[model samples]
Target: MKPINLAAYFLCGSNRESFCDRFPSYFLRIFRSKECPPNEEYLLCGSACPFNCSNPRGPVLCTDDICGEGCYCKSGYLRNDNGTCVTMDQCVGKDEVCGPNEEFLSCGSVCPLTCKQPEPLVCGLACGMGCFCKAGYVRDTANDKCVTPDQCPTEQCLNQNEVYDLCNGNCEPSCDDPEPICTKICKGGCVCAPGLLRNSAGECVSVDKCGNYTDGALSQYMNVINKILHL
Candidate 1:
C-alpha cells in the first residue's frame, strides 16, 4: 500500500461523505481559519456558542464541548442578532422611541425609583435594556406612568413651617447643631422650610422663637443669627 497523504486524503477523496463529517476536528480547524470581520477575530478552538446582546454572560450550560474554528466577537463586544459584533451601548435599536418622561437605555438600573420606593437604599449592578424614567422623575405605579416625585399621591405637609421635599437631607437646623454636615444621600419626606429651625419640641420655628425653650437654645439661636448678619 502507498504511503497515504493525510492532508490530501481529507481534502479530496473518492467518497460520498461530506468533508466536514468525514474529516477530524483538527482538519476542519485548519481549513476554517480565515480573515474575520471588523471587531471580530478568528478563533481556532473557540466556543461554538457565543455571547450575544440577549444573553450577555452566555449560556450557563453549553452541552456542546467540541471546540470549532470561527470568527468571534472581541473583548468588550457582543454579537447581535444580525451576526454583527458591536459594543454594549449599540445593542439597543436606534429607532426605538420611549414614552413621555421616559428614555431608552442600553443598560439601565434594575432598581428604578417608584412611588412605593422613591429612595432606594441599595441598587444592584445588574442592568437591562429598556425604557426607564428620565432624570428628576419616578414611576407612579398607581397609574403606571412616569412623573416627577412630587406628583406621587401622598399626604401634603400641613405645618406651615415644614414643606414637602422630594429629596430631603438628614441634616436640618435644630436646637443642637444649627449647622450640621449631612451626607449627599437623599430621603423623600417632609423637612423644615427655608429660614426655619426645628425647636426642642420637634416643631419648626423661627430663630427668635427657639429662645423660649432654654438659655442654651437662645444662645445658639443668637450665634446663628449673628453669623448670618456678619455682626
Candidate 2:
C-alpha cells in the first residue's frame, strides 16, 4: 500500500497523540513533535493542497496539484486584501495596471514591469511574502505580467549574466562599439539573469532549484545573486 501522508497532523491544533499514533509504529518511534512556522507565514487552509486560494479548482494544469504549493496571483490579477486577486485600481492607491499575460507582483526594482506594494512587508500580515506568479507562470519584464513562455524571444539573446545587468525594458537598435549585446534589440524580455532560471511560478529563480516546481527558492543563493546583479 502507498504510505499515508502524515503531514496533515502537523498542522497547528491537529497534533494530538491520537493523530500522531495514526502513523505506522516503526515510523512513529523516530517521530519528533510537530513544528510550525509562524501562523501568518503558513496557514493550513491557504498553504496546502492544490494552489490558488481564490479559485480552488484553479487552472487546467492544477488538476493533480500537490500540497503546499507556492501560492501566487494568476495573470491579469493583482493582489488585494489578504493576497487574493483584484482589479488594478484595487491594488492599494497605486495606479498599476497589468497588461495581457501579466499580473502585479512585487518583483523588486529589477523587473521592468512592477506593481505597487499593497502594504509594507511587516511580519504580521497574510501576504508578508509578497505576491508572485501562479504555479506555472513566469514574469515577463517587457510586458510586466506572468506569461507562458512560448519560445525564446530572439536568436541573439544575451547570456544569463548580460541580461541580468542591462535590459531595463528598452532594447536599443544599435549603439557605440562594445554597446551591450542587446544594442540592436527592441522590446526586451526577461531571460533569467545569471544563476537564475524561470521557475514554475513564472519568476526568475536560481538554476539549481528550477527543475523542481514544488521546491521553495533557496535564500542564500538569492542573496548572493542579488549582490552580484544589484537587483
Best by TM-score: 1
Residue range with the least summed lDDT across 10 consecutive positions in model 2: 171-180
Q: Which candidate is the best by lDDT?
A: 1
Candidate 1, poorest ten consecutive residues by summed lDDT: 1-10
Measured against the true structure, the TM-scores of the candidates, in listed sequence, are 0.46, 0.18
Q: Write the per-residue lDDT of candidate 2 for residues 72-153, one digit (tens) a residue.
A: 3443444455755554445554423333443344332222222222112333423312345554455554554655543223
Off by over 4 Å in 1: 1-98, 113-124, 135-137, 148-155, 212-221
> Candidate 1 on 65-145: residue-level lDDT in tens?
877667777766778888899876687653333558976665778888887567765666887545689989999878878
